[model samples]
Target: MRCLLVLPLLLAAALAAVPPLLGPTLPPGTELRLLSADLRTLHGAWRVEGRRLLPLSPPLAPKAGQEVQLLLVLPGEKPRAFPGMAERGDVFLPWEKEQVSLLRLLKEVYGLAPPERLWP
Candidate 1:
């Protein structure tokens, strides 16, 4: 009987020692390399205003190896972005009820995408 109680405690400790599933959070102001030219024309990215995408003209031309930062702003919260590019498909944000693709965001939001890749 005493062993059972101790077993639960041991299990709890073991689970606590396990690291979280989510990747490590990136610190603010971390510089990222420009991997795509579409990112340079990010200024042309559109904004979502009640299902309307308003266009903006950006005259930026960032070259390869140019340091850039990507920031994402959600309603009523601070801006945030995660590192590490996904191999394919859209990453689902269950909490936000939205799915997003890093490749798309890089091109649409920052106008950047790898030279060998095509922009949407």
Candidate 2:
């Protein structure tokens, strides 16, 4: 009888602890390198001058002359394009999502602690 009663409580406690243990909270300034270019056309040498930051969606797709942003583990670190895009000889990030601006995304994605000034 006692074992049955204790089991549910133990299970609940264990489940509650699971989420935090899964991963460290990202820092505010950290960034993730996401891809954002077409890879079907490129065949081989993808290293070229066509790459840019990750795109934004909903309002519009990224295009030339537009400033795309990325969430990177390290700011300004560039990533390689996909096979198709590479064959075309251009670099590109291929993923797109709508959210905060690049600077804020970097902070949230990386799980950086709040700024000193913001702290009480």
Candidate 3:
């Protein structure tokens, strides 16, 4: 039935709109949605203004074999994540390559807008 076909499409669309849930819900205004085994996003980034990100939720500490993914959402493009690891009970995300890259991208939106770099 046409209804059956449309139902799946609607469900798929809705699922795409939702972000991934790993640890405690990340602080408000930030969501890390797992897109697949290798892709993900920080949904609702349009609300960010680029500044030091302080998590409102408890720190993110991945269990063994797990890693935290941070993705950047650019206009007309998909979200991007910097790859890194956070051991359990670390209490903070390390400012490593992936974290710094993610922060640089976010800074374009929330932190003071820099003109030298391009973000979209």
Candidate 4:
């Protein structure tokens, strides 16, 4: 019976490691490339505001904890490839100066903001 208690804890940890990316957590115009997943078998990709990826009609849906590479195409500069992961439907881009602008936009759009901005 000891295994019963441990089961829930193990499950929780696994889920926590790879949480779903939900709408409102991502902005439009985000580009993501799947690293390891079956495309043909997978139907329709995730979209912003629950939008789906295009060019493939049903874009490749990102799975929680799925590995991905982020291509941040900054203006006047070559697109930068950054390592990130998929959560929910959006890829979690690592912290960068550009995120400051992203955070501000999200605040205005969602009326919710990350507390990190409030401190210092």
Candidate 5:
């Protein structure tokens, strides 16, 4: 019957209208590393040191004096670095429009649960 066919089509249309459900949530303490820069020319390994963020290692730590730059390879364009001071137990980067969104993305990718508060 035309009504029966229309019913299935309507069901299909309804399903399509719904957005795909997100997968299981990530656990806490998970870390994400955004590429600090293009390392195609440089030679060495770098370690991640923050949540949903990456920081340059001290030149003397392992690969001392190696030239490196942070290049964010996101959709819009190069990644911009948020500048801030490190005090107590947090790295304070300058607040920007994308800062919160970036942090949330990093948390999702890294499987980090929402924190009680931003680091001070």
Candidate 6:
């Protein structure tokens, strides 16, 4: 019946309307790993600017990976033993190659502005 078919469609729409769970913003120095990722090319390397990591040069695409690591220089800050999730706006510095790249979470209404970068 048309009503039955529409019911499924309505359910699907409702499910689709649900927004994704954007995980909490990970603090600076949170070490992340590159389990899997996509390659991106940028003009320059990443550096810490205030509380955010902005590129010295214009960003080509974004050297974003599925996971990454963060390094902190403060006292009593050490890497974790177990693995966990990395959400958007998480900024990480790549000390070695074959690792994930930095992240600048942009979660605004327009999503055009970059989120605050977390650095130690």
Mark the regions of model 4 whose C-alpha exceeds 4 Å error after superposition: 1-58, 96-120
For 1-120, candidate 5 gives per-residue lDDT tens digits of 899889999877854443321223222322222222343432211233333233333221213222233233333334433333322322223334322233333343344433322222
Which model is ahead, 5 or 6, in terms of lDDT?
6
Q: Candidates ranked by lDDT, best first?
A: 4, 3, 1, 6, 5, 2
Q: Candidate 2, residue 97: CA error in Å?
A: 10
lDDT of each: 0.36, 0.29, 0.36, 0.41, 0.33, 0.34
CA RMSD of each candidate after superposition: 13.4, 14.6, 15.2, 14.1, 14.0, 11.5
Off by over 4 Å in 1: 1-45, 49-54, 82-101, 105-120
- Candidates in order, TM-scores: namely 0.29, 0.20, 0.28, 0.34, 0.23, 0.22
**TM-score ranking from best to worst?**
4, 1, 3, 5, 6, 2
Would you list the clashing residue pairs of candidate 6?
31-70, 32-68, 32-69, 51-117, 52-117, 89-105
**Top candidate, metric lDDT:** 4
RMSD (Cα, Å) of model 5: 14.0
> Which should have the higher TM-score, number 1 or number 6?
1
For candidate 6, report its TM-score.
0.22
- List model 2 lDDT by residue over 36-75, tens digit each: 3432221111111122222222122233323333323422
Model 4, range 1-120, lDDT digits (tens) per residue? 999999999976854443222232454444333343333333232223333332323345556676555443322445445455556544455454322122333334433333222112
TM-score of structure candidate 4:
0.34
Name the runs in model 2 displaced over 4 angstroms: 1-24, 27-31, 39-99, 108-110, 113-120
Alpha-carbon runs more than 4 Å astray in model 6? 1-22, 29-40, 43-53, 61-105, 109-120
Looking at candidate 5, the ten consecutive residues that score lowest on lDDT are 58-67
